[model samples]
Target chain A: MDYVLLIEQLLNGFQLGIILFLMAAGLTLVFGIMDLVNLAHGSLFMIGAFVGGTLTLVTDSLVLGAVLMVPAMFAIGVLVETIALRTLYRRSHLDQVLATFGLILFFNEATRLIWGPEGLAVPLPDFLEGTVALGAGITYPLYRVVIIVIGLLVALGLYLLVARTRFGMLVRAGASNREMAGALGVNIPVLFSLVFGIGAVLAGLAGLIITPITQAAIGMGEDVLILAFVVIVIGGIGSVRGAFVAALLTGIIDTMGRSFLDVVLLLFLPPNAAESAGPALSSMLIYILMAGILFFRPQGLFPPRGATAAP
Target chain B: MKSQLTPAHAVSALLIALCAAVPYLASALDEPFYVIVFARIMIWAIAAISLNLIMGFGGMISFGHAVYLGIGGYAVGILAFHDITSAWIQLPAAIGLCALVALVFGVICLRTRGIYFIMITLALAQMVFFLSVSAERYGSDDGLNILWRSDFGSGIVDLEDGAVMYYTIFAVLMGCLFLQWRMVVSRFGMVLRASQSNETRVQAVGIPTYRYRLAAFVIAGVMCGLAGFLQANLERFVSPDMMNWHRSGELILMTVLGGTATLFGPLVGAVVFLLLSEMLSTITIHWHLLFGPFLILVVLFARGGVMGLLGSRTTRD
Candidate 1:
């Protein structure tokens, strides 16, 4: 095993973790607070990338486009909540799932219609186009490092907003008991919209950030959204901290397993057998972990305190 | 639960008769494609009916129900590829394997309720999907094409003959509906439905609900596998796409759109859904744009489904 390769993959895992955390955070909050399962959350990610990437292309300033992406997604979030999802909060989980799944179909087709089938190119600005060297002769892309920093900063900001502010307390209260919070004069509907907007922003930001690295093709978020679901399920739904922890764990496990499972499998099986099984097993590693976790603790590793599992 | 004839049962009978007439209707209209299209609908209808057993009646919503369809397809596809074309072997293998997988998955998934059950089932199915996609020896993402249809080893049931294949599917659909009707009305199904409404109460009444649910889940899986088996025979093709998350979503849509927990609802829903898709796709490739919003509207307001709109019994939550 080369030490350099190991360190590089670790960084890769970390970077992936940061991205998953961004997506999972919003998902956890929405699921926690609104008690809605928004499968179209991934559609927001796709829309964010498309809308943000387009803005950048038109304005020719990545910073401005990125800044504008926030309010754009937030407004869309609020609009969707008020229109499509508000009635769904009290509906059955199956209804929420079906509605959101419909949203996914609608959004994907809408994107194809508006943006055409081709992915929009969000070219890296000149300054972000280089690699930075760390000590021990290991170097990594500057863009990925920036993503890590931005992700951590946002994570910290979210923590402070959720933990330190009065609104954060209300949000937590809403998660724990919505009826109590409503009786206590919290504007529950407005709060729901606000939290939904925040989730949209986070999901959009995650999408916008990664579009430069991966093509913002139609339905790009569908695959990643499943991974986010895995994060929340393993982390326990309605728990932000759990989402964060689960996201990173999922990211690292997925990345490392994909890169190194074959080598590890070689020790236990013949070369040809190991080669075929490696990819399949690696892709399944996290799900196996999730199944194991669920078998032992169906509520997940860090279920929210005092919140009903179904809600 | 009633023995009297109702509009629901009449509609179901009418639809099945329509399905029986599809081949003749197609040939009379001189359009061979309609036979295949209605056959496709019947296959999905079977899958939808299986899903309804667990979801509509049992209250165990499996978002990954289509995986069995894929597994069934692959069973036949892989067997036919290896020159094991006998329906005797392929049919049993598909049903047995699907039942076993459903049993294991049901054990783990039943530990959770509501959304967790939904997500876990979907995730597990996705696990199988990724495995299939990575199986380079089995044609992976491109899917595998079988050279021979399942050999029933008799002159009477040649699958390569389109009429025979279509009728086989029709018989299977009729069999599934009969089985579903029988199971849901039986003592076991009553226990299952009772548990769905209130598990604790049912348990207090001295009925163990877990085994009933597990049995229903496995039966549903086997039914869906039969759908997959027929589909593979119809197309002579199998791919991971058959079992992906989207297919599962569509199955759920069919069950719900036709009205869940009702006799004939799956058939009605499948007919409407596939017909709509076929009609919409003809107008433009972006039919999902319309179809998607329509689904949302259905979920939002038309929760009763086509059968419900047509005077089926009210569906329970």
Candidate 2:
């Protein structure tokens, strides 16, 4: 109930929101541009965390682990797109869902087989280890602050890449009108592979950055996949700016709800009932937010232009 | 209409008859496990059928259809706990509750199409899951155990008897299959299929396709509820895990793997999925390691599923 605790929780929420944005950006881009529903995006995140964790353990350097993960994830992304997903682009959404869902099953089991079911811990670097002091005796994890900073930088970079760059223009054109982009000799297939690779790298980057905070494990991507879906839905599909805002909003709302919901409920209900209801209600908070938003704007907060009714 | 059935129809009917007779034959031969496995497969078949109704017929890809199973199971569990084990009360309540929930959720979700629709349904189901986990009165995350199965009158029909329970499930499965077959050929089903093929055309033709789709969603939910009730009785337990998103994925897998849009597809899918799981688990602890790649192979090569593959070959010949 104190101001300092509230502020700390708010910061925690913001950090979570940033991470969700990172995950959602790639998903929205894939959906908007490719018109493909890739359920395996979460697997990309899982792979990133697993690979990054292993590399960090070997190299004993967070920076090097992250740097290596980008290219590694990019390669995997391109390979998957070329080998499996290319055929699915011409198929129905149901087929795409099944195929990608298969990829998820494959990736999860593969990771478990390789890394074991027990989660791997990614230790924070010495400089990012301790808590930084906030005003009024409050403290927060330095690593989390760095994540927020990095996430924002990525968000800004994405905005510039999509809105200002030539590649971004082609991507936008492809998203808005795929056949037209192709007709204009945009090399649609190669562009699609590039987009897929970028998305994979972003997902991997998010996984690597969040690994220090959360122990890397198989099936870790499942929950985050759902969260990223929520983020994209709330932000408006195919909009990075929207994903950033929605991710931050969801993260803060979800974190604050989890941290303070019990305290808030105590005012209306008895202590035991409040304790029991709090966790359940907190878990539902973001979903409720999503439902509310969709109720008002079925297309989401910032829907991409030329997006037709999805099949 | 002609009284004679087509050769294909006759063959399917014969197949169903053979399957029904297998349980009795197995029990008579002192192999009750086969009957038990068949019964389990039938229960999941019912669940898969429900998923196909939405995903295949209505063009709605719901990633959380397992929530209905959970709802149905919890209905039976909660009722049994309160000393109301009569089918007269429990069965209606289960279907009704699932339908009500589906109606409310579908009203909001059916507005959106494609990926957004998929994600929203998933998120809502997850919310339901979290709620189930939080409710301490219902055993929370640990789940609840049923003390007794749904009771019927003595002598005539006793669900406590395994043979009787197996027969009951088989009868229900047959009834569901028949109903689905009849539904798909009906006028309403035509509209539903039309929507699935081309919604814009259906809308342009002055059909308010959303309403039909919503109705289909409710019907599917109710059927899944029936499956859930049987599952609770069969296992003598109910838990949140029954309604997990993973279970939903499995339901979708069953539908696709068995040749969606076909009348017997869900049943075929369920039987294959369960049998495969049972066989693989017996062989190795890390069965999923093998099963995962198998799924990928199925998707990559077998786009038509088992039945579709069979149907195509037969047509060619």
Candidate 3:
């Protein structure tokens, strides 16, 4: 019944929504442009968190670490694409899924071997730490507010790039029809590599930014990766606009459900029943939403115009 | 129609014989642990075979197929926790619940194909996983331990006996292989296989492929649930981890490793995968570093899996 708590929860939801968008954006783009289901996208996210966090700590500056992390992840993404994923593009989706899955196991264990089994804690730099007040006694973490702004800026920048640029047109064309795009003289391989690089950068960005709040940890990517998968599934795979909307929807619903589903359920169900069902139901909220959406719109909320009707 | 036997057939026979004789072999070798190890493999093999039914033959790649295992195991575990010891009730409930859930999931998932199908199944199964993880009454993430196995009358069957348990699993494994063999060759199986290659063409021939697919989905679910039931009995415990997405991926890997769409591929794949894991873990704690790339190599070069190597691509398929 407290309004301030509700406002704070909403802000928390917004922050989560932004993070989910960052992860989902890369996944949707890679899926749309290259027709690859990279399960190790999560591994890239994990690597970003580990590498970026380490760099920030070592350099004693967050900006320097993030700035350096982007290209490194981009290179890694491109390297993986050419070495493992490129061959899989022509193969069945099953093959693509399994290969990326292998990549996931490899990355997780490699991180464990290097970082050891213990998770890394990335403390917030002094300047970025504090509470930001938004009038009427409502306060939110300054870092989270920063995440919301940066994520929104990225979303806007992405929208403009896709809408206004010639490269954007190529991306669209490739997504819609790779063969025709290649026939018209687009460097499909180069374009695919570039898109893959971009995806890795986005995943890394999401990973690094969230680390200060969540701390860089091993196997952290799989849970969030599954969330991103749900977002894209609900948003329609390969659609950035869809990813944006669905990510926010998923993030908000999930945070709010986890925070207050028990309270809400208590109004209807008896005490013990509501108490037990609340947390479980809350965790299941987005999936239930996803299932409902699939039941209604099998293609998702924003399926690409021609997302390979073949199969 | 009769067909000539090939080396794949010999391999298949050998595998069944090997599984059947695991107890004697283990005792002869004086490695009692091998009985437990191979029992776990057979249990996983049953689950993988069920996954292959839809994924390989039907071309419906359900990334969340392992959820049925969790559901089945939980059914047994929860009932046993509450003092329900009868196998009759627990077994039927597991099968019926898994079948019903699969039917519901099939209605929604079958609506999509390819990657969409894959993601949706993964997400829905995650839903059930979370549900179990949150069930505080059932020990939640810690899972429940069963002191007693299912009772099938005093003298009719005793699952608690190791040899009896081992033989029971062997019977079930053979039953699954026989059932899968028969199902994939029947008119229904032919229709299902044709649909996998080309659904539009199958429909044009006046067959309702949707119903056939739904039926197959339910059957696969029931089969996997049976595996879960046996697993709970074998391990004497059931945890939410049984249904994790990682386990689902492994099931897919096993099917592909043995050779998708082949009759004995699931069993072959399960044997190799578990054995490899067992062997690798002993050599080093970081077995995944090796195993992961090995999976990649298999997908890249060994596309037909072990059965494919044995010349098992029958013309009938």
DockQ scores of the candidates: 0.81, 0.63, 0.83
DockQ of 1: 0.81
- How well is each residue in B64-87 modelled by candidate 2, as lDDT tens digits? 899999999999999998989997
lDDT of 2 by residue, A4-122 (tens): 88898899899888888888999999988898888899999999999988989999999999988889999999999998799888777777877788788778878888998897899
Of the candidates numbered 1 and 2, which has the greater TM-score value? 1
C-alpha-based local distance difference test score of model 1: 0.91
Which regions of candidate 2 deviate over 4 angstroms?
Answer: A269-273, A309-311, B1-11, B153-155, B312-317
lDDT of 3 by residue, B17-67 (tens): 998898999999999999999899999999998998999989999999999
TM-score of each: 0.98, 0.94, 0.98
Q: Could you give the C-alpha RMSD of every candidate to the true structure, in order shown?
A: 1.3, 2.7, 1.2
Candidate 1 lDDT over B29-141, as tens digits, reads 99999999999999999999999999988999999999999999999998888889999999999999999999999999999998889999999999999989999999999
| Top candidate by lDDT | 3
Off by over 4 Å in 1: B3-5, B314-317
Better of 1 and 2 by lDDT: 1
* Residue-by-residue lDDT tens digits, candidate 1, A234-291: 9999888898889889999999999999999999999999999999999999999999
Residue B139 accuracy (lDDT) in model 1 = 98
TM-score of chain B of 3: 0.98
